[model samples]
Target chain A: MRNKFAEALYRLSRSDPRIHIVVADISPAGPMNEFRKEFPERFINVGVAEQSMIGICAGLALKGMLPFAYTIATFALYRPFEMVRDDLCYQNLPVTVVGIGGGVIYSTLGGTHYAQEDITIAGAIPNMSILAPCDPAEATAATEYLVGADRKGPCYLRFGKAGEPDITKDAIEPFRFGKLRYLRRGRDVAILSYGVTMGLAVKAAAALADKGKSVSVIGCPTVKPLDREGVIEVLRSHPRVVVAEENAPRGGLASEVKSVAWDIQARCALQTITLKDEFVHCYGSHEDLLAAHGLSVPAIVAAAGG
Target chain B: MSAAPRRLANDFDTTAARERCYRLRRRILDVSQHVSALHVAPAFSCMEIVDCIYHGLMRKDESGAYLDTFLMSKGHGCMTQYAILESHGTLPRSALDEYCTKDGLLGAHPDYGTPGIAASTGSLGHGLGMAVGMAVAERNAAKAKGRPVPTIYTVLSDGEVQEGSTWEAVMMASTLGVDNLVAVVDNNDFQSLGRTSETHPSFYPLVEKFQAFGWETVEVNGHDAGAVFRAVTARKGAGKPFMTVAKTVKGRGVKYMESVPIWHYRAPNPAEYKQALEILEKVQS
Candidate 1:
């Protein structure tokens, strides 16, 4: 997913001279090296200063330049949160904050690198658009939409690490901001997932289907400006719904679904497959951590009444 | 207020500038009269510095578009910028009258979207980094178009410099060689409820710190518009970022309130307000 983001950004920069990449002490490698080689003047490495990185992005936006601020999800959103609120969102600038390795993708790197609370923080800021693309294809499409002309105001693009296969199976819709896309159709129950967890959601839906339980798989790429009506419609139609995510339960997909469900008094049994409130202190691979935290396909399937 | 910004003469006019500063000080006091709490002292400390920038330093082109940008990073001292913006004709007089009111556009902090405000700042340690960003963008854009890079100016408070982010910005600015960027620290020696020197003695010798950080650094009397102007303008094309530590009185122009920490966020009582006005009137005489 990170590689797809870099490639998509590289492709976009070919036509848009206004696109500038601002990173904080992250070394240039792979596609980034090519981007640096092609646009030496445009790539700014602020040298491990996250706060300054955010401020500079706002400054660039003020000068009519579109800046993509990239870093680990934790640093991108947590380190300079005030700058995100004051400099970018407050000004409603067109600065795209690209937070790589969203969720516990950096599983072995410990809690400091984990981005369990990015959605809660980023979603609360006004004028902030969030996109958590599930796979390489969606990641590419999301990057293009965020940095494209008619630029959206102050967006947070949350992506996972590389090598996730396409979950959409070439049945992708033209990427729409703030709208939910469905990958499977059923009636008895539905599983709505976003970001890297969409694969697990697809697996869970298939597992539930095999057990003779009709289940729908929903892909939520646009996290903020959540599909409120879509959420309500799904709640009203299904007897049970499961909102799955890699983030904390407090303000992730489940929180949005719960809030929307409450607004119209929808009476569906809503369940969540999310990270525990505590940190994943154990060291392991990303998949191991996900399984340990009850986000494995079988766990999700069990939660979906398989 | 004039409908268009009144550009000051090219030559430095100390006496005229002094007179303008006094009038602006008086105007700022008048605007803050009805408000219950404000950083009048902080604003007064940077009044001359901000006055010099908007009136004497910030540039405009033949099309009347401003060539340079200024961010009030020391957001609490925003009254100074607001008053100057009014005089610069960027804002109407009515806006000043409605300051901090329910229907007013103005707040304790400077918010972006107000005419002439490039960034919303009041949260300390935010403005300078944004200024550095603006400078980088200006330089990049200029290099792209083969034009001269426009300067970016931001004012910081003495106490605000204590924030780690401020140093983060300081380190990044010089490292990037943001020569088009200029910063003026309103060194009034006071924090919210204490003197910065007493609260944090190590913060002293700021000039040497900035110098060591790879910047062209200087210290000046912040209240002297001419000195502030000379020190700041001297850094143009200096090939490095510049930092001016302008020593100032916290509650300048109000004799009894000057250097008084309690005056940091207070509206003067009737007697104090009268005495403050009398002090400025005496300076006018």
Candidate 2:
């Protein structure tokens, strides 16, 4: 998945001179080496200065360039709130902030690198579009969408480290900003999910279908300006909706779905499969963290009362 | 004429330029009082700096021949900027009255949509980076079109230096040899929390620090309009960015408010406002 994201960035860099990338001394680790090698003049390694990297990216954007600043999700969002608000969003600059190792992807790095609060923080900023791709294809699509979009605003693209399932094929429809993709159809319950958890939700829905339960799975690539209509339509038909995400339950997709549900006064059962408020006490990989957080297929199914 | 006295005469004559600065400051204070907003101290700190940059340093041209762009990184001090713009005749005094009011163009911060404001900044640590970009872009455009480079000036807060983002811009400006860019720090010594030294304790030997970072540095009393003007107009060193440390009082011109931390977030009451007005009026008179 990381390779696919990197490949898309590499391909995009060829055509756009305005597309620049700033790395936090982690380009090689973030799988952005190809981009660095290809566009050496544009790529900047600011050592360990995440805050400064964000500022530099804002500066680059001010110079009529689109900068995709990359860093671990935790440091990028937490350390540079003022820069994100003042430089990028307030000015409405076209700067794509890519957060790798989102959620529990940095599980081995323990609590320090966990990016549980990125979506929440990014969502709070007005005019900031948030994208959490389900897989590499979606990630590539997001990159292309951001590069070509006319309305240049701040965007946060959150992705994991590597080795994720390839749920999207090349034939899949081109990713549209602020639009959701309906993967499967059912009437009994709707599975609304994004990012890596979309795959988990799909697996859970498939399992429920085998047991004679109807299920629908919607992959929400864009979290901000969320597909309210799609979510409402799904909720209007299905009595129960399960929102699953790799991030914390608070301020994640689940809360957004619930907010939509509440606005419409829908009485359907809404379940969320997400991380609890507490940090993961154990050390492991992304899968282990998800499992511990009850974000696995079986756990999601159990949460949905299947 | 004696050399020292002649220099002093030239320097003191710049005070005549303070009429515009005073008007700007008065407008800013009036707007803040009307809206009940608390930014008068920060606003006053940058009034002379902004006035000197726009009126003294920049050359007026629709073609943008001289200093093409100016940005206020310390956005909370927008009143100073508003005053400068009004004095420059780009923005009218009527617009200054609408500051911080609902549906008004002037908010507590500098905005790009506001005429003459290059970038909008309220959140600290953003303006300098944008200024650096503007300078780089101007240089690139000049190179592409085979024209002389235009200067870019960014006004920043002394407290903003505590933010790592400012240093990143500094590093980039130095490494890229952005001699066209000039960053002026309004060294008022006070941030949101009392004095900066008591809180962060980072001693900024600004000239030495920036010199080490490959920038030509100058330290001046920010309140001295002539010194600020001179510092800004000084020739750029070869292949190096420029930084000016403008030593200033936080709540300048107001007797009770000068160097006081309370003014950082306090809007003067009716009595205090009257007192402030009287002090400023005395200076003007």
Candidate 3:
């Protein structure tokens, strides 16, 4: 997924001079060396200055350039929220904020680097479109969509570290902003998720199916300006809906799904599999955080009563 | 001191201009009091600075052409800006009365839709970047169309220097050789939480810091309108942005209010309001 995202970025930069990237002295760590080498004039590395980098990107966007600000999710979203609000969202500039190491992807770095709260913060901002793709193919699709589309405001794209399994097929429909794709269909329950967590969701659904329970998995790549109609369709068809994400339960995907359910008067049982209120104290890899948070396939299957 | 006073036309008078500054200060106090807004201290601090720009630096006819470009990045001091615009007849006095009210264009911060307001700002650390971008754009557009470049001015609060974005804009402005840009920092020594020295200390060694960043720097007493006017009207640097560190006093005209931290947030009550009005009336008298 990381390679695909980089390739898409490189391809987009080839045609659009307006597409620029601001690195926060962590381009090599964020896997953006190729982009730096390719577009030197368009690439800016304001060393270790996360807040200023975001501001500079906002300024570039205001000057009629489309800037993609790259950094780890923790520093990208939390460190410069005021800049995002004032410089980008307030003016509705087309600054694409690309956050790598989302969720537990930075597990080795512990809680400081973990990006479990990105969705909550990004979701709260108005005029900001959030995209968390399921795989490399999906990431490429999202990149193309954001670069080419005439968006109303700024956007945020969250992706994990490299070498994730591909969940999307080449023949699938082209990605659209705020649209959902039903990866699998069943009758008993609907499994909804996005980002790298979609892999767990798919595995959980397959496991549930093996136990004689029909489970459907929906991949919602876009989190904000949510596909309300798509969510309504899934709720109407299934007796229960389970929202699984790597973010906190509060104000994340589950919260959005709940809002939709309430508005449409859907009586389906809505369950959310997410991180608890307290921070993770144990130290391990990304996989450890996932297992500890009960986001693993086996845990999700058990939660679904399979 | 013996230099001839630079005049706009036959009607320009130093005594009249001084009187206008006092009137402008009064309007700022009234509008701010009515709106119950903060930043009154900083707003008062920048009155003469604004007056100097409107009367001395800006060319009346060319000012209208550059309306789409001016940005008050230090948006907290919007009352001063409103008063200056109203005095210039660019904005109506009624709008000042409706400031910070619901459905009012004059927000506590300057908004884009308000007459003569270039960009919406209240959020710190954004105005300078926007100004830099605008200046760069003007330069690019001029090159493309073979037209003269438009001037861009951004006002910065001393507290805003703590924000890294200010430096980012500074770097870019220098890198791009943005000669048409001018940034004025209102150095009133106070921020939102406390004094600049107490909160986030900035040792701005003004000229050295800006000169190192490729800017032609100037220092002036912000209250002295003559010095401000002279500094702004000076010749532009060769392919480098200009910066002015204007030393100012928070709550300049109001005697009891000057240099008081409470004035940063506290709105004037009826008694204080009356007293402020009286002081303004005496200045006018």
Candidate 4:
């Protein structure tokens, strides 16, 4: 997904002289390397200065220049939160802040590298659009949508580390901001998943099918400006709804669904498969950490009452 | 009364500029009378610096639009900007009269959409980095259009130097060689509650810090509009970024408030207001 974002940006920059790329100390490999090579004048690498990167992007936007500030999720959102609020959100500039390594994608590097609270941080700010793409295809589409002529505001484009599979490939609807996409339809139980966790929901749905029980897999790519009416309708039709995400259980998709269900007083049973509120002190691979924190496929199936 | 908008000329006199500063300070005191919770001392510290920029240093075209941009990173000192903008005719007299009121466009901080405000800044350590970015964009625009680069000036407080983001912008500006960027640090020697020198002893040797970072640095009396004008104009188009350490006094115009920390954000009482006005009236520009 990260590489696809760079490729999409590089392709878009070919004709738009307004597009400028700013990165921190992160090494520019793969498609990003090609972008810097092609547009050396527009590529700016403010070494290890995330706050300055955001401030600089705001200035670029002031001059009618479109700037994309790319860095890791924790560095992009946490260290320079005031900068994001003061420079970007307050002024409501058209700066695309790309935060790679969402959730536990950087699990081996310990808790410091994880980005569990990004959704909460971004959701708290007004006029901030949050997009957590599920795969490379959706990542490209979201990038294009954000950099389009009309999408003029601050936005957070959250992606996983690398090589997230194309879970949204077989979906009936194409990628659109603030829309809930259904990957598979079933009447028994509905599984609502966000970002890279959509694949787990799909696997869990198929596993439930083996027992002659029908299950639906829904992908939630746009976390902010959620499909509230669609979620209420889904709750009305389904007897059970399960939310799967790799973020902290407090303020991600699960919380949004719960809030909507509470407001409508839906009679359906709701459950969430997510990481614990505490930090993950253990070290392992991304899959290992997800399974340990109850965000795996089995956890989603269990949450669905399978 | 509003001053007529004028273009920058080669032989402008400093007496007019100083008198303008005195008038701006008086306007700031007027704002203080209306609003109780604003940084009066902080505003006084940067009055002349901002006045010189808008009235003397920054060039204006025939259309009354500034060719160069100015940002106030030290947000608490926003009354200085509001007063200057109002007097410069960019902002209306009614707006200054209604500051902090329910129907006023002006507030305790500078907002972006307000006329003459480049960026919404009050958060310390934020303006310089954005200034660097504007400088870079101006340079790019100049290179593409074959025109001279426009400058981006920002006023930061002395206490704001403690923020890490300030140095981060400093490093990036020097490395990018943003020659059109100018940062003036209002070194009033006082933070919000205490003296910066007493609290942060290692922060001295400030000019050398910018010089070492590859900037053309200068130190001058911030209250002297002529000195500031000379420092900035002497290095115009000098092929490197510039930093001016303007040594100023908090609550500069009024003797009772000068260098006093308690006067940081206080409106004057009836007796104090009377005394302050009398002192300001008797002063020579």
Q: Point to the candidate with the largest TM-score.
A: 4
Give residue B237's error in model 4 in angstroms.
3.9
**Model 3 steric clash pairs:** none
TM, every model: 0.95, 0.86, 0.85, 0.96
Best to worst by TM-score, what's the order? 4, 1, 2, 3
What docking grade does candidate 4 earn? Answer: medium
* Candidate 3: tens digits of C-alpha lDDT, residues A1-306: 877887888877887777777767674533356777876656777667667677667656766778888888988888888888777787788888888998878887888888888888888989998999989889988888888865657888899978888886732445678888877778999898999999888888878888899888888899988998999998899988888888987888888899889899998888888877668767787768888887788877876777
Instruction: Name the lDDT value of residue B87 in candidate 3.
Output: 73
Q: How close is candidate 1 to the true structure, as a TM-score?
A: 0.95
Sorted into a CAPRI-style docking class, model 3 comes out as acceptable
The candidate with the higher TM-score, 1 or 3, is 1
Which scores better on lDDT, 1 or 3?
A: 1
| B1-285 per-residue lDDT for model 1 (tens digits) | 001123334556677778887887888778768788888888888888887887678887998878888888988888888888898788899898999999998999988889988889888888888888888788878887888678888899987798888888898888778888889999988886587778789989899999999889999998888887777766644567988999988888888778988878898876777778887732221
Candidate 3, residues B1-285, lDDT tens digits: the string is 011123433333446667887787776767666756567788888777776666666543444543225578889888778887887678876787777678766677887657887667887888887776566555655654676666677788888877777887788778767777878889988766767766655455666888898888899888877776667666365788889899988888888888888898678988888998887532321
**Candidate 2 error regions (>4 Å):** A28-31, A170-174, A187-189, A209-215, A265-269, A303-306, B1-19, B22-41, B59-67, B137-149, B190-204, B250-285
- Candidate 3, TM-score vs. the true structure? 0.85
The segments of candidate 3 whose C-alpha lies over 4 angstroms from its true place after superposition are A28-39, A170-173, A209-214, A262-265, B1-23, B29-40, B52-63, B87-90, B112-115, B129-151, B162-180, B190-206, B209-215, B229-240, B253-257, B260-285
Q: Which has the better DockQ: candidate 1, or candidate 3?
A: 1
Clashing pairs in 4: B75-B122
DockQ of 2: 0.42
Model 3: share of native contacts present?
0.25
